[model samples]
Target: MQPTHRSRRILRPVRIWFVYLSLCVALLLSYVPTGQVPGVPDWVALLLAFWCVRERQHVGMGAGFIFGVLVDIGYGAAMGQHALAYVLLAYAANAVSRRVLWFTPLQQSIQILPLLLGAQLVMVVVRMLAGAEFPGWGYFLSSVTGTLLWLPLHFVLLLPQYQPEERDNNRPI
Candidate 1:
């Protein structure tokens, strides 16, 4: 059976709030220091990428750009460095998300690696362009860690979507 108009209306606001809360959490994580971690912890990037997968329309290029700027401000990095990287990375991820078969955990895991790496590469280039010297090859390690973290993260946020799917399946013809 088709969803009633009232159900659709109720879901709209709920979906909006979900996206908003995810963005807020992403921003907050970006600011938290990693302490002894050799570089930025993978959680922030992984969370951002996970949000992009789940809420592509809501967390597209513009949102990614804004988050990047916020990170730069919070981290006191060169202006626009993270912004440019994030926007480009979001665009790439958005494009890939549309075509990729997302049914399997392996597929999703495979898809996330390139998106995370591309974003990190963009930041590396931007830093170099801005005359910031290379920290080391170790900087890219965050992308690896981020990609590994994506699996558990994706499943957690995806629980709501699964409930809706199961409910639809249980409905009578």
Candidate 2:
């Protein structure tokens, strides 16, 4: 049976702040570095990647540049450091978003790992160009950590918008 207009609208839960809140959480986490590695997982990059994969139209390279600038300022790193990296990351995520979104979050985690690594790689390359000392292989660990965190982050961010399971009244005998 087709859902009524009201039910249809109800089923399509869309909260604008859900995206902003996720960004805010990532922004805050960026300031709170954690991990046994030399670099912290790029929280904002991961967040941006998830949104790009989940909802491309709503988030894109522009969003990445904006947040990337914020991170650059917050960390007092080189200007456009994260900006360039994030733009590339979002662009990459958006590139394969179609195929990636079709998979489960766990699968997405695996697929997006390299993109996450690429973002970190971009950042490292930028820092290196700016004459910053190499942080060693430990720096790359953030990608793995970020990839592992993707499933949890995806579920938690989507939790608020999740609809209750519909009754299977149309089940066949």
Candidate 3:
């Protein structure tokens, strides 16, 4: 007989302040100009999706909109481009949060690729409508990069919430 293993860890409740703080950090990271860099992930959108999935109640469309707008202002892109993209990303993430949580981080990243792509697609379409030329295929690489970062980012973000590994004899988990 094979010994059964626990696939999931019980996590402490996430602090609301930490969530916003991490988002702010991501916002700051995005402000750094990586000139001509291909496959540089959209840090704000990536972190927003992570929070949307992990803490759906605390982070959702409203947070998405605010950060998206900030990203727009920082990038000097057309207003509402990233905002619409992020709002849609949040909704999609929320809708799939439960299902995505059932999988490992690698699997979750695969599942989330579409959501990331959809968000990018929204921005592309909005930009085109605003008379901007197509940004070319390389623009989509950010979504792929974000997907690749998902596994590590998952462990890092959840590290604080992981319960102590030592088993206590007095208390039943």
Candidate 4:
């Protein structure tokens, strides 16, 4: 049976709430220190990048900025550090999402490498500017590990497929 417009509107909010809940869970998980999990990536960044790719409209730059601020507050870090990183990362993910149909899950995962790395680099630069000591190369490992986990995470999350129209026309007809 076809639902009325009112029902559709109601369901929209429910879907949004689910997304918000998932993000909150991801945030909480990020704070859980991994004990001897030698190579676990930054769960929050991985989740955020996935959200940026999958739900660009809902998880836009402003949302990223706000989330980053929250992270900074929670972790007791310099203000605007995570905010800048999150917003920049969100923008990068969204920009490339427009051309995403050409990429497989593996390719998309590979693409995340640069975004993650670039975001970390920005964070490092910001921290340096704020007179924070260097955390060393290990700090950047989170981005690398995050990128590697993207494909599996995407599959696990069951994100929506890219629309056919979004596919690039520059390739074979």
Candidate 5:
């Protein structure tokens, strides 16, 4: 029993690492070209928001900053642009984490839309500041799509983690 318990404890960190691995996969998918496809949802943002609402303690501003920097470096954007945006998004999500977690997926999506939009707004502002031309209203489409994706992503990603506990009806009083 002691050996089994010790091994279980060792696996806990590996499980936590799997979460980060999934996030990295989402980040990679964000950059996948879709042959002129429009409104490609920001997988990183969606994942971060979901993790924030689902496991707030695990998805903090630090995670946001790290992932944001990874995104900036991977996507060839200005340094600290995505970093700042993601950190702000994480902070906003964390602020309302307690409240948001109680809401259904649809409600959660509605509540989180602002934060997702805010992240995009940050990107736009940064680009504009750098003398880049506007990318048009189409740029906002990702937020909408990302919001729509929340329901399925939330349910699906959390499905494996949901474990129903059994009640002991035969216990002696």
Candidate 6:
């Protein structure tokens, strides 16, 4: 006898408040002193990318621009540097969200790596244009770290939306 596979259940829609709260947390994380350390992922960028992919309709360039501006203020970076990077990130994430949702988190991370890298590249270019010296290649380590973290972040973010697994014999779902 062949084993039959069960279809995956649809996840509950993500709440808008929860998404904004998570982004706020990400902002706080980025504000931590350790953020200057090599390989410390850009928490705001990572979280923003995740939401852009999962809830493009609800969270996109607006959230990106707002949080990006906040980040710029927090870092005292050139105004709109992070904002531009994040807006582009949101757009790219939304553009590919459908295809990304079709993959496992591991595979999704691989796809997201380039998007993260591109955002970082945009920041670097902005800094250079503002007459800042190159921060060096180590700066990109954040994207790598963020990519490595994608799997766990994926599970954590989705946890609240998962429905209970108990079978309800009384109801047809």
Residue lDDT tens for model 6, 1-173: 53344236567878889999999999998988884578999999999999999999999999999999999999999999999999999999999999998888889999999999999999999999999999989999999999999999998999888765665888554
| Candidate 4 vs. true structure, TM-score | 0.77
> Candidate 1 or 2, higher lDDT?
2
**TM-score per candidate, in order?**
0.78, 0.84, 0.91, 0.77, 0.83, 0.90
**Residue 162 accuracy (lDDT) in model 3:** 77
Per-residue CA lDDT of model 3 for 20-39, tens digit only, reads: 99999999999999987989
Which pairs, if any, clash in model 3?
none
Off by over 4 Å in 4: 1-14, 34-38, 159-173
What do the candidate models score in CA lDDT, each in turn? 0.70, 0.85, 0.92, 0.75, 0.80, 0.92
Ten consecutive residues with minimal summed lDDT in candidate 3?
Answer: 1-10
- Residue range 94-135, candidate 4, lDDT tens digits: 998867635677878888899888888988999999998887
Q: For candidate 1, write residues 12-78 as lDDT tens digits.
A: 1127676667667877887787764654644546666666665687778887788888888988888
Residue 162 CA error for candidate 2 (Å)? Answer: 1.1
Listed per candidate, the RMSD to the true structure in angstroms reads 6.4, 6.0, 2.6, 10.4, 8.4, 3.0
Off by over 4 Å in 3: 1-8, 163-173
What's model 4's overall lDDT? 0.75
The residue pairs that clash in candidate 2, if any, are none
Question: Each model's number of backbone clashes?
Answer: 0, 0, 0, 0, 0, 0
Model 5 segments beyond 4 Å from truth? 1-14, 163-173
What's the best-to-worst order under TM-score?
3, 6, 2, 5, 1, 4
What C-alpha lDDT, on a 0 to 100 scale, does residue 163 get in candidate 3? 65
lDDT for model 3, please.
Answer: 0.92
Task: Give the higher-lDDT candidate: 4 or 6.
Answer: 6
131 Cα displacement, candidate 6 (Å): 0.8
Query: What is the per-residue lDDT of model 5 for residues 5-76, given as tens digits with 9 covering 90 to 100?
Result: 221211111245657877898989977866446588889888887787667777788999999999998888
Measured by TM-score, how close is model 3 to the native structure?
Answer: 0.91
